[model samples]
Target: MQKAPERLIDENGFRLDGRRPEEFRPIKLQVGILDNPDGSAFIEQGKNKIIVGVYGPREIHPKHMVLPDRAVIRCRYRMAPFSTEERKNPAPSRREIEISKVIREALEPAVMPEYYPRTVIDIFVEALQCDGGTRCAGIVAASLALADAGISMRELVSACSVGKVEGQIVADLFDLEDKYGEADMPVAIMPNLNKVTLIQMDGKLSRDEFERAFEMALDGCRKIRNLQAEALKRRCEVLTGTEMPEKGSLEAH
Candidate 1:
């Protein structure tokens, strides 16, 4: 059996990235970042960088996959040729297909498919850089891209990963930590209803450890939900040329 490397430590309780157990890595998001797509967004979380593009509620091609009662959500997830330390071949691997399916399933519940029967909503996410948790990051980016395209959704989706390291539960595991940590659990959440749309786990954990990790993931999701809301509000402000009113201004009116 391979032994794990020496655990990361900080005398003040910070992790390798100098973040507290529950704090997330820095995240940057931009909508409409691609020129040719109906909707697109870029998201960077720590060292992970992903771009998501959304096209349609357009007519379904091939004519046979369209359903009578609902629109289909299609997703393709890919890793760029230079996306990792070791170059990945320029082909979609089985892991990418699996992740794409998971992302599509995660977003399907948020969309109202009945509104666009016989059509298709397609999303493509490209991982330009990876350091862990690309699937969760891609899902979040896809949700934002879909919303930016003005598609209706029951709620916005937010995702993050949590893990245990050195007996501490940490949020947003980075590459090294994820590779060496005791466990990793990624979750996709619908914040309005406090429901989970996707959950995946790897590594070993006891029952209590699983519960603790889950709680941490939930908390991370809520924090990310707030950030997502703020990003959308900022985007709307930019598009409409209207500033967000002061907190008490509406009450004053």
Candidate 2:
């Protein structure tokens, strides 16, 4: 096999993609992109692309798993066979199962499950492309899909990844950086509440570095939240023939 590439961060502090340590990849979001699901959204962050659909507040299946006082939330995250360089298997992998659980937990705090007793909310996310940070992108898209469905939510969820590359903390690692970087951390937050709902870390970091990475990730999340809001506003405007609302102002509590 050929040798791997050189260090991710250059001596001038620019990444392989020419981004600074704290810069995030460009993100685009679109809401209500599908007609069948109660809500649907698509997102492109860097080279990662994902679509999510939200359904329910409908009856729970099996009847045994129903919550007496709250709606049961289920999540499924899948990667398409062509999502990566090597065609992934069609079946869900163990990693997908774990991510599904984590994503469900992240949205649980924002959704008003108590309002829909004996019901269930199902969130499905599909990865159409992969470039690292797919989970973060999925969370952001899923949250928008939920909102588009008009589900009762305390706030929209936004997420991004941060990592230590060449001893420098960087925001939004791409596939190459993620594979070679020293550490990776992904975070999800409720933008309106200013509360973190999901945080996962890998590799290692000192306290100071961890804090720096967290702040950088949070900043990225806030920016993603703005994009999410813009997507929602655009859809709303299209339907109502109104101007776009101020960012985050349309957030429902």
Candidate 3:
């Protein structure tokens, strides 16, 4: 077997991007962007960019898939042909199918499916760009889109990736780190309930290392949750033509 690659962390404990072990890349979110979709959102986490649109809670085609006691959740995750370094085929591959299934499961727990029985809720995620951790980023965007569309949810979902590089756990792995890291784990959480919705790990890690990485992922999820809420509030204000109250104003108080 080939020897392990060089360490991503420098002597000073700074990673290639100059981030510390616990630091996450800046994340930005925009909600209610698409005109036709019931809910839509866009997100950028580091170099990965994703757009999510939610439709239905309206009707289900194929008639047979409809549920009597709850709504069915369907998801499609696709990476654009130009999303990565190499040109990719436009057709959905096995990887895309698996991702779609996982993403649907990740968001299902937060949705109040029983409220819209006999209907279907569809989530479509498009990856406009990819560096690393695109699946986790998609989860964040899709959750926001559901909220923007006025879908009832038990809680907002947030997701982030954590990786161990050179014996240190880092939050939000970038391209280089993700490619060469010792271990990679992506996690999604329902922040209000402090419950994990989805988690997957690749590469070997000690039990202790796994616990540390998990905790780090939770912290990252909390931060992303704040950003998600802020985006939704701003979108609501924009749609209602209402200005945000001043920090010390009575409305704010």
Candidate 4:
């Protein structure tokens, strides 16, 4: 581990970047940005940039791998060579493989796999930049891409990471904080259904601290969910001349 900076948080409780414990980095979302993919979306959160493309509900290739009762969901997560200060190898790393699988399973609960039996839904997530929380950001963009593709889903999934930094539970951890933090916990949920699709932790937290962090993460996801709705609404406006829903306006805007 890299040596911790003298302080990750100042006396005023502001983070190194000047954000409060509950604040997230600025986030931007764009949906249906690609012409060829069945569905696509992009997300920029803090310095993490990711694009997701979805294809399918089409026939599954190599028939034997197909499930008779549901669609097969596959996800590929890759960080571009230029994504970070150090050039990443083009070949998928074990971390990429693991993150891809985590993202796939996280999204599966929201998708109605039974609606497209024997078909496949492939999600491609490309990380153009990295700071932290790339996996959660990928999950956010992938859910939007799947929706843009017209896939049947119970609800859109949203995700965020919270951690104990400098003895404080903080929301939306950035790269440096996660590096030196005591604990990092990521959570994903189908907000509308109040269902948790994924939860993973690195390091450890006390029971009370973990509960607080989990709730903080959920609040962040709900905020992101509102942003997702706004993106879809904008896409609808452009494509079909639909008006934005007043009730769906983002809380943090």
TM-score winner among the candidates? 4
| Local accuracy of candidate 2 as per-residue lDDT tens digits, 1-253 | 2245698888888999888898887787888999999999998877888999999878887999999999999999999999998889998899999999999999999999999999999999999999999999999999999999899999999999999988999998998888888999989999778899999999889999999899888888887787787788888987787854554432211
lDDT of each: 0.85, 0.89, 0.89, 0.91
True-structure RMSD, every candidate: 4.7, 3.7, 4.3, 2.5
The per-prediction tally of clashing pairs is: 0, 0, 0, 0
> For residue 83, what is the lDDT in candidate 1?
86
Model 1 weakest lDDT span, ten residues long: 244-253
Model 4, residue 198: distance off in Å is 0.6
Q: What is the lDDT of candidate 3?
A: 0.89
Query: Candidate 3 regions off by >4 Å?
Result: 1-6, 245-253
Instruction: Please tell me which model should have the higher lDDT, number 3 or number 4.
Output: 4
Could you say which candidate leads in lDDT? Answer: 4
Could you give candidate 1's per-residue lDDT for residues 39-136 as a string of tens digits? 88888888899999999889999899989999889999999989887888988799898999989988999988898889999999999999989999
Cand. 1 Cα-lDDT: 0.85
TM-score of each: 0.91, 0.93, 0.93, 0.94
Per-residue lDDT for 146-239 in model 4, tens only?
9999999999999999999988999989888988889999899999889899999998799999999999999999999989988888888878
Writing each residue's lDDT as its tens digit, candidate 3 over 1-253 gives: 3344477899999988788889887787889989999999999877889999999788899999989999999999999999887887999999899889888888999999999999999999999998889999999999999998889999999999998988888889877788889899999999989998999999778999999899999988998888888888888888998957652211100
Which candidate, 1 or 2, has the higher TM-score? 2
Q: Which stretches of candidate 4 lie over 4 Å from their true place?
A: 1-4, 242-253
